[model samples]
Target: MSAKTNEPFTEEQWLKFVQQKQLKFVECQDCHKMSVIPFAVCTTCGSRNITWKQASGQGSIYTYTITAVPPPELQAIAPYVAGVVELQEGLRINGIITGVENVNSYPADLVGKTVSIEFLELDRKSILAFRLNA
Candidate 1:
């Protein structure tokens, strides 16, 4: 499967795209709405026509929080930073954040910080992540 197309629209395909470090999203041709996850129909206009669009991987942190205690599956990487990043294309996606020295008492200026999409290999799978821009 190519990273450029959303053929075989499935959550697994979406994860594969993310694993490839490709920031692909489904855009509705009718309403021109974009979503990080692909759907059978556009929720905004009930349109069945959606195309995959690749993002520039550039974005700014919309908000963030330190996960001192993560879920059972992510306990191995506890005390990590995660946040919503607003992409340049006007889409917001949630991803794990990297480059923070200390999750506790992190810098207040983390919000609105520049970031780029990254992939983290964990549990034999690629997890979506973001790298703080220097």
Candidate 2:
């Protein structure tokens, strides 16, 4: 997402993160707790110690759902697929899945299939998406 959103609720840092085309996650320096959300304190230990690390962007589809009737904002891109991806880093993050041509149709075997990062433009926002690793 871009920092120039007409909507005021989106965080600027998240926009910057996408603009950079880098997938990064946070880890507590004190306890090594990992999370995708950027936070000042560790969600596990409540410690202020935190560090950021780039993700490999390599993962597999842990679970997924093909939305046939998307929300109004995404009606233009309806029948899209969203999924919970399990990264090789041992973190699961929600992301869009691309390359599925048929909206009303979907793959029968997406679970455990390899995926790589692919960015797509949505609502003037740069979003992180996943696709077949090949």
Candidate 3:
């Protein structure tokens, strides 16, 4: 099967980005800032000398919102928390936080706490997720 998004990249590339469970980021040779969602050139310094590095998979919740209305496929998973996480490597990514049974009952103090990656399987595709560290 293919990814639901129909991205142009081959399955091998997509699988590498998924099953490998390694968070890949681009480090700008000019600016030295790392970026997620790998690119051909550094978006910050416009340098093509970017290199890939595996992330530590550790991060903190920078901001988030409770998603009440999602796509039909996601409706069954309503009231899920969607948040932007600031990775230890300094890149931010939007992802769903799992393992927290109740979003409302969960303490607001959960923010800024450490989290780690948790790969999720959906519709034959693997997705990257996160959960608060114990």
Report lDDT (CA) for all predictions.
0.84, 0.78, 0.71
Model 3 earns a TM-score of 0.75
Which structure among the candidates has the greatest TM-score? 1
lDDT digits (tens) for residues 69-121 of candidate 1: 79987888888998999999999999999988766776667888899989888
Instruction: Provide the lDDT at 40 for model 1.
Output: 60
Can you rank all candidates by TM-score, best first? 1, 2, 3
Query: Which wins on TM-score, candidate 1 or candidate 3?
Result: 1
Residue 123, candidate 2: alpha-carbon lDDT: 77
Question: Mind sharing the TM-score for model 1?
Answer: 0.83
- Model 3 spans > 4 angstroms off: 1-16, 44-46, 104-106
Candidate 2 segments whose C-alpha is farther than 4 A from its true place: 1-12, 101-103
**Residues forming the 10-long window of minimal summed lDDT in candidate 3:** 1-10
Q: How does candidate 2 fare on TM-score? A: 0.80
Global local distance difference test of model 2: 0.78
User: Which candidate should be chosen as best, given lDDT against the real structure?
Assistant: 1
